[model samples]
Target: MNIQEYIESGILEQYALGELDDAQRAQVERMATEHPEVQAELEDVQRALNAYGEAHALTPPPGMKERVLANWQAAIQSEPGQAPAAPATEPVVRQLTPPRSEPAAAEIAPSRVSWSMAAAVALLLLSAAANLVFYNKWKQAENDLAVAQNQQASLASTMQAVNKNLTYRNQELAVLRSEQFKTVALLGTPAAPDARARVLYNPTTKAVYLDVRKLPAPPSGKQYQLWALDQGKPVDAGTLAAATVAGDSLQQMKDIASAQAFAMTVENEGGSPTPTLSTMTVLGKM
Candidate 1:
């Protein structure tokens, strides 16, 4: 590549910006050594960038000058792979100040101080930014964990409800299949013609179940109660607590023996010992 043409292609600008990879950097360094023009251009770019950075740097920390001078001196004296108490061009201190026509002590001190201060400020800014990034990441992790726990709880609750329904269905099927139990149908009265229910009972065990099909919502203070009718007398079996029909519509009622007939009545809350004959909604005989 033509050296002048390569310089104008913007690779030097990238070097000044510190954006070049190791290979690109090596090539640029080699070209600069071979061409004095390339060397001068590279120096001028570095000086301009350094000047811009120094101008905008924050105030230096207290006693920074003393520490910087101490560390720098120790570095040159104790550096490895070099002669101890090294012979050099103008002690390391003299090289710290930017080259100027005056080269006065007053001019050099402030320049060196500014360079040290700029480095300290850069380190502080980097530390603060890193802390902020970590804090945000921690908060996001906590939010994700909370969401996962809620989803887990919802899934567990759904599983429990499914298992409960499955158990009820198994018991319901078992009772229906037994030949020892009798099935009775209760038809709605004129008061509630659309209401219908059924009962399955085992005479041997006196276990009874009521199946409510089409019943209106009960009044706020009233409920439905089941009864066993035998020998012209009505005995309280149990109350069907639910006001409206629910899944399967099957609920175990009070168990009794010698029940020749069955009945249902609308009564007060907690049910009454006797059926309210006036509010009877259904009746059936064996």
Candidate 2:
């Protein structure tokens, strides 16, 4: 639909030369009617064709007129007695040769050259149009490939997220359904009324699992630690971050046995040897 490209397309030239088929000619006609530039270009091409034909116009031979006149007089004299008389000898075949003349040879040379020029122009235009078609097709293919790649990447991300969630859920189910594990809840303290955590413990193996369900993320360079109280003394149960992420719930912590209570406290990066009672965010007595 690019007018400039269409204008330079040489379709007008082909139209002037009467080289295009009916459908193509109709299409060019529609274009010419709709676009003034196309119409003007068609007129220009027509004028050029006319100019070429005039410049190379061929004339009849000098003997051609005399020969035709002689034939006509002989026929008239023979036919005077009766109706139009037949020729004494009928011509067997028509002549296909052109008259020999210097002017005619010059005219023929120009005509042949013009034909070659027209053919070359037409061939060049066809090549250009074909290239445009192939270019458009190549661009469409590239766009389709890009869309497919994006869709595939999106599908891959979705699958990865689903698998991660499934893995987390399976781990949770394993701990929840096991008879050897016991569940414990850490209620929010007065210091952090909204904080809460859960613990899963196996008494036989002293394995501990911590899930911080509702707790604020620890400040930079600080972490949360768990302590098990046995005989009124604090024991290092485990350490973990205070933040929770999707597909990540329970964190494995140090094991404990024979604990009377479990508590969580916020401390510096490595954690303290003893519990910071004032910072205790949650506590649950077994």
What does candidate 2's lDDT look like per residue over 1-286, in tens digits? Answer: 6988997887788788889999999999999899998888889889988999999988878899778766865775577666334564223211232233434675888899999999999999999999999999999999999999999999999999999989977987898788988888998899889888888888898988887778767777877888988899999886785434111578778988778788988888888898888888889877
lDDT of 1 by residue, 11-67 (tens): 888999999999999999999999998988889889999999999999779999778
Query: Candidate 1 local accuracy as lDDT?
Result: 0.83
Among the numbered candidates, top TM-score falls to 1
Determine which window of 10 residues in candidate 1 has minimal summed lDDT.
Answer: 93-102
Off by over 4 Å in 1: 1-112, 243-248
Task: Give candidate 2's whole-model lDDT.
Answer: 0.81
**Candidate 1 at 162: error in angstroms?**
2.4
- Which residue pairs collide, candidate 1? none
- Please give me the total number of clashing residue pairs in predicted model 1: 0
- The candidate 2 region of ten consecutive residues with least summed lDDT is 89-98
Clashes of each: 0, 0
